[model samples]
Target: MDSISFQQYICNLDPTSLPRVVKICSGVYFQGSVYEILGSECCLSTGDLMKIVDVQLQKVTCENMENGHMFDLPQDFKGLFQPIPETPGGTQKKPFSLNPFSTQSKTAEFCGRLYSLQEVLRSAAVRQKRLSCLEIGRSEFQLYPVYKVKAIMHFRNGVVKIDSTLDVEVVDVTEESRDVYFIKPLMLSEVLLSDHRLPVEAEILEAPELPIAFQSDWVSCLSKGCRVHIHSKGSSRQILASSQQGKKGACHYFLLSSSYKGTFRRCPRKFSSTTELALSLGPARKLQVVVTKDHNSSEEMPLFTVGDRLRVLSLARADNPSGMDMLVCCRDNGEEEEEEEQVRLPLFLEAGFVEDLRDNKKYTLSEVVQELQLPCEVKVVPKDAADPLGSVSILRLEAQIKEHCLLVSLANEPSLAFEIPPKWMDVPLFFTEGSEKPSPPTSCSKVEELSEAFYYHLLKLLPSNVPPPPRPPKRRDSKLNNCPEKPGERKTSAAEISKPPFRESKSQESAKTGARQDSLRYPNQYTIQYGPQRPPKPTKPCFQVTGTSASDDSDHDYEELCEEVQKTVHKLQRASIKH
Candidate 1:
């Protein structure tokens, strides 16, 4: 019989109830334990019993058995697979070697021929018992083998919800094993849910259009031509905006939310705001007057004396009473808008003779008033009235009369004004009535002659110690020109006839004595010498003495006489001298 048939038979019979002698393909083996029975059929030792079936199954499959065949089992098969050494008597057994055929060369040879008919049966049965599991669709739950239906159904209702209970065996044909199992379903849900129904395609309604109501309040008013509009509420009270023109005026309108406002007001004429008043009234024009001296007419004359009373009248009032009143009162006319009025009093000259007259031709009335030292008030009594009227009336009446007002009435006419003529009353004068007359001035000719004679006499009386006047060189022909020559007389050279040696010697001696005396008196003291002492010698003697005087022994006396002679010669000398 074939190995498949034998394996079928062995599988049909239960191992526990098997008879002692069993017929396999090759021989009948005595059955003891399951291991012994399997080992004996495979021709292997009991030690390798579990693997014997596997080795035999491989051999049978590889041969693709045609019919029952006889095979030789190698000798020493028992020695080939010696019993694996036991672990410590009570400990768990060690895992057997996976290469059951390579247990030993002897065991391999012997078991190599035996067929694995029982292994094929056992594998086929195990395979048949395996259940498969598959993942189907979106739910992600797994389908178990049909054998685990009860457990799966229980898990669906949550009765049997153990994590590991679906341990059904599954055979994977692709991998040749029964290994994996499937788990029950896991479900997920959304975090939050609402009961209200949601709309799918409702039309969006436009909000009702709001009417823009512009609000404004009067914060402040702007004058004409203002570009800024004031707002009632904002950070700043005013703001700038586009200009708006209306029948009333031009103005600006601003939004309420603006923060800035204009504060400056425009001037009508910014550049010409300030104007300058008149700076110049032109150069001042001076007043002119003519003054003359007076000599006759005592009553008409200016009666002046020291400490005499005097008064003055303004001639500006001579034309009319109003004029006279204006002059007397000295009221200012307020005609100019920007100019101030200057008040002034009329002037008068006191009763006094002329002390002095200034030669000023361009003297003004004001200057005359100042020069005359005139009083402001003068009492005048009409010839009819004895009592004195006020000064003002007197001045007014005097201005009307148009006649010269008497400045003073003195006991006597002052001598200072005696030279003034009576006709020149208009000519003002300052005088001294009681002042003494000044002495007369001497004649110029008489003074000159007196001075000349006095100086001549002084020169004559001067001491002999006085220095002599310097002399110039004489010409060679001077003597010849002045005197006539005798027929036999020889003309002497000017150098030979210059001076007598004796006289020069005496003059030198006198000079030496005077110098010695000066040195003796001053003695070793330092004296400053300033100019040249001596002049160059003259070409000729300047003088020719006509007569000799006695007492010539003393050198000083000779020097004195020589000086006198030199003076006389100077007097007679020609006027023309080279300066």
Candidate 2:
């Protein structure tokens, strides 16, 4: 070696001593130490000491030695440690020597190669690889990248699929739109936070905080990445059983829907069923008496009165009992018996039971009698008779025979029955013209005519019942005289004419006196006057005083003179009469 420097020799050393001799390489200083190493700022000896052997050095220069291997050297010593030829004719380069002084470099190089090999083996083992069936559990399984699973479906066995591919068919698709339910999903992480199994308790936190979303499919993944799947073969049949049990309990109250049952509870039976039966009991049975006439002979009979007993026997068959067959005894007194003959009579028949008659149907008297069972013989008693005044004739047994012949005739022919009796019907009487005096009965053909007149007079006696006729003129003669001014005209003042003096001729006065005397003699006779005449003047008498002195009686005489003066003045008024 041609003067090999210690720094050059150290630069050719390997990095196996890097761990133990890095401090020594830093402390040593050699020539050409100012040249920079590629990775570190330490001298060339320090870089060589830190270098790894199996990790090929980058951006480094090398020198040659007698061996065939190349030795790493400092980039600044490129000209000095050039490779030496092995032989003159041979093309082999000589390898650099291992310096005895660079023991730390070789040791550093060996430890670096061992650390790099360990890092490479660790990276190779971590690469992704597909798992075999043995690596997974004893069951067949799928490995999803990123640990993300969408849904799961469990079969009848304990086996499950990650995403099931079965198609669902519905019997009636229209029911899906008509009946729908709202579904909500929950995640495993959210369930852990709440730690509450009850639905009411979980509602305290809002549904959005539960990390769920709505989906139309049967299988879905919840918001927190939890898988939710519908397993058709699983043991979820308990839900249907609970729903059916709830419906069975609700069927016991079916009586609430019936309309007929509701009405029966609200209404009474009497108002609903038998209303016509209650209205049929109207008037009761009694005795009645009346006068009769022969239909063929047209003859009248005497009046019947009270205390008479009438037997009303039904002519009905024995098998049917239409009404009760009873005898009625009359109890009217003498005055009532007299009234019975005078009063208008009513047609009487045996009363029948109403139940036998159909509604709105007419039945004959014989038919009704046949329905009610009664004795063939009936008795009718007059009020004045001793033996209970009853009928003994066979005519009374007939069902349709008239109770009273006159009454039945009157009911049929009212015009004939109202005929006036001879004495009681009419009589002549007098009445004043304007007075409210009752008029005596006048002759009329019928009793009804007289009764009408009696009612008219009775109406007049009651002031409130009758209106008054117009008043007659006061002066009858003045009306005949054709005077322009009416007689008895109202005077302006009473003082103007203190007395109404009459002006009559001597002959007229004498005739009037004679008529007055005649009216006094016969009070029943009425006097009649013909024409107009003035009223008579009142007379005053002349008195004489006897055996009195003429001078002493002079004042009395003066009063007589004044009286005579008044007479003279009135006498003048009589002479001025226009008539």
Candidate 3:
């Protein structure tokens, strides 16, 4: 039996100096409790670092410090454990967290999840059994120990309190605690005010004019972990009625119509969808318009301005039996399906239609003709054949033309027409009586004959001869003349070769060969004849002496004497010339 405090036991036991067979001692005192010393200390407190010294049948010997004493411990005892320094504030470490998400232990959470000692041991035992089975016959079976344990409760506030002998607490909140959302003209994020259900209350911090597509549909909102969908704006009355009808504190929302139904509690965190721009044409037609605006619009509400022209399928006022105002409408997007959809405005917006033209005035068919200054009975061509790549088709329709452009009513769609250019019209359209069989127009033959004649005339205009290929440029004089003339041809003399080529190869070769033969035949002859020696004698006098000693002290004072000598010599020479 032993009785010792956890602190004293830890202080006396050296965990790091554990040996294969640890020397366990029976202790009589441990925090005023008497207990028999077992193998190893299995139950470990938080911030108490220890090591397993030895293992026996269902028992272990453990030491707390590298130089401390060892104590026998049972194998079943388990608790949270971590290293605590031996200095002041040694017990500052908190207990290991079972949350699995928090960074509480080094080796325990190495798998990126929290693991308890008991669970770890259990998993190890399971793995050992699985491995034994695999060694026998179940080789295909694999063992994957699960490290994350499901938590009974999750607190988003990130503060956890624990009660035990250690009384540990964990607080982990790294990022800002507030939630942020963005609302744009294209899309918006809303928050749910209640639980999961349809017709729930939601709040858009600052609501903007929503797109027309959002009309008559349910929208989902998520707040924290709860989700809700709503059919209409949450009014106080509807919210009250919903609360009364359903759970008291359930999802709060206003129901636009009891007929509405939706199956979304918590929608995904993000929802992205494009909104189409629509313009109301008349009482019936809605046209899609391509919107060109900044991705991040500055205005709270996106709106169309004046002087914008939207393109749409061609329409004429005459075609409309009601004779309503007509305007060309275009959509901002080019999606194929969207082209067919019309814009629907809310009831409050009295101006249901948005004018596509810069000027507010609407023109009738007659007015359009007058404005364009078009003449009646103009050729009309197919729209497809208007471009250069488009081949002219045989079919032709002529209604009225203006500035080489024609507008002909479409047969299938009377309300719409094809705007054609003059070039698109196939030449020489022939109209035959209904009774007579249709055939190629006779004018086509004439056109062919005329084209042939024009082509032949163009050919005649071109010059008959290409003016013989320009003679190749004459070769310029170059060093190719370095090669001697042909064997039989008159050979150039040394004068010619040396004068032009500078050093003649023939002369250089002869001099080199002769010098080489002389050196080889008389190896030491030249050296001996021109040995390293001074000349035997000088043919000319060293100086014009005029009777002076070879070594004279007067040399130092010769400048004065030399001057007088020069004067007398000059006088003698002048006299001699006179004589």
Q: Which stretches of candidate 3 lie over 4 Å from their true place?
A: 1-197, 202-229, 232-359, 362-579
TM-score, per-candidate, Cα-based: 0.09, 0.10, 0.13
As for model 2, its CA RMSD to the true structure in angstroms is 52.0
* Model 2 stretches astray by more than 4 angstroms: 1-476, 479-506, 521-579
Model 2: per-residue Cα lDDT over 217-292, one tens digit each? 2112112222111101111100000001133332110001111111100010111101111121123422222212
Best by TM-score: 3
**Ranked candidates, highest TM-score first:** 3, 2, 1
Q: What is the C-alpha lDDT of each candidate?
A: 0.23, 0.24, 0.26
Give the per-residue lDDT digits (tens) of candidate 1, residues 1-579. 122222333223333332212122222332332212212222211211110111111121111023323242222122111112223453322212212232322222322332222332333222122111121111211111111111121012121211111221111121221232222221101101212121111111121122211111211111122122101111211111122243464332222111111111111110100000001001232111111222222331232223321111122222332111111111113244544332222122111221121232432223323332221121222223321111112110001001111111111222111110111111211122233433322211100011233223433443443224223223335432555566876555333444467455788999999889754432322111112334544644233333444343433454465566666556545443633
lDDT leaderboard ranking: 3, 2, 1
Clashes of each: 18, 24, 41
Writing each residue's lDDT as its tens digit, candidate 3 over 362-452 gives 3333332344221111121223433211221211111221223222221222332222222322111111112222121211000001123
Error of 2 at 202 (Å): 79
The alpha-carbon RMSD values of the candidates against the true structure, listed in the order shown, are 58.2, 52.0, 39.5
- lDDT, candidate 3, equals 0.26
RMSD of 3: 39.5
